[model samples]
Target: MKEGYVIRDQSLPHFLTVTIVDWVDVFSRKSYRDCVIECFEYCIKNKGMTVYSYVIMSNHIHMIVQSNEGKLSDLIRDFKKFTSKTILEKIQSEPESRREWMLERFKLATESHSRNKNFQFWQLGNHAEEIYSEKFMWSKIDYIHFNPVRAGIVSNPQDYIYSSASNYIDLKGIIDVEIVQIPVVNVLKSSSVVKYNSYEK
Candidate 1:
């Protein structure tokens, strides 16, 4: 039996945040962080997801996103699967001297969860809470940027190179996700809209 439950809403746009196991400082390691970024970039280009904002914390990730032309659940699932496998392999195959101890520790943690493999990169289902309201959306965005600061890792959110904070703050650029915010009119109107001009009696 799966320990986590899935949440879905066909009525409104969705935003999801996922955390790591035991809050282990995964993002502190460059290899693991790079793997995550690789996966996210692949998804945006290949999958039909519009990733708005994202931040990589010590042990978690916050993403403001919605599927543009695909199922959100499927996209998330593939991201997790592909990242876990590729990252684990990258760690195992790397010639870096420092990675040996880190890889051993990861192996130890994955022992209980490994079904038929040597190691496991991530735990079970990622906890998700849908963002429906404007306040909630902004709150999550701020929370994502502030995660590294709260952990005492970086002084400024923009200094954290693994996040979309710099892009959001400067409106300059992002690696995988686009930083453009949906206009109020876009959110309020249906997919097909001829014009915003209107008159009422």
Candidate 2:
């Protein structure tokens, strides 16, 4: 992992991206996406995680999160480990049309890494970029909310149910998030914007 992507300050909130191995569309299924939401809810309730903003795409997830317990790295590690196991099990047991294909891909992904026993669901590293300034924080939140729009999945950010964009717009989201109470003007004035595709760490 690159040094910039490393979670240097575990106590502060960071913009995090966890991509699927080989960019597989594991989360294209609603069941798989629900598993991720359940995991996030569990983390928030039991693991001291505070999700400020988030968006769940087909192959990856982005979030602005911090740990009240000041153990962001550990929280993320456990979240990934649990989600990887649970989602893999679901793919095998649930009514997935691409079960065999997905399983084979996951199996092949583990061949190079001896640490994995059967499969590798998530790709290594969280691509964590610490939120250093207010402008950067809002920029990441904007980037996250607009992901589905950029993909042509939804015309409006709040129309995406799997994202916290709805929460920002005052509608009840699928999962609870710690809404940042910044003025709309501040979000618009955040000049140092971080583009989604331009992120390389």
* Candidate closest to the true structure, highest TM-score: 2
Clashing pairs in model 1, backbone N/Cα/C closer than 3 A: none
Candidate 1 lDDT tens digits, 2-105: 84646575323455666654555656678788888888878778887677778877677778777776477788878877876776677668755546665666
Residue 145: error of model 1 in Å?
Answer: 1.0
- Evaluate all candidate structures by whole-model CA lDDT and list the values in order: 0.66, 0.87
Q: Write the per-residue lDDT of candidate 2 for residues 1-201, one digit (tens) a residue.
A: 433688888899999999999899988899889989999999999999999999999999999999999999999999999999999989888799989998999999888877898999888889899999877887888889989989999877888999998887755899999987665464544453323222212
Which parts of model 2 are misplaced by more than 4 Å? Answer: 1-4, 183-201
lDDT against true structure, model 1: 0.66
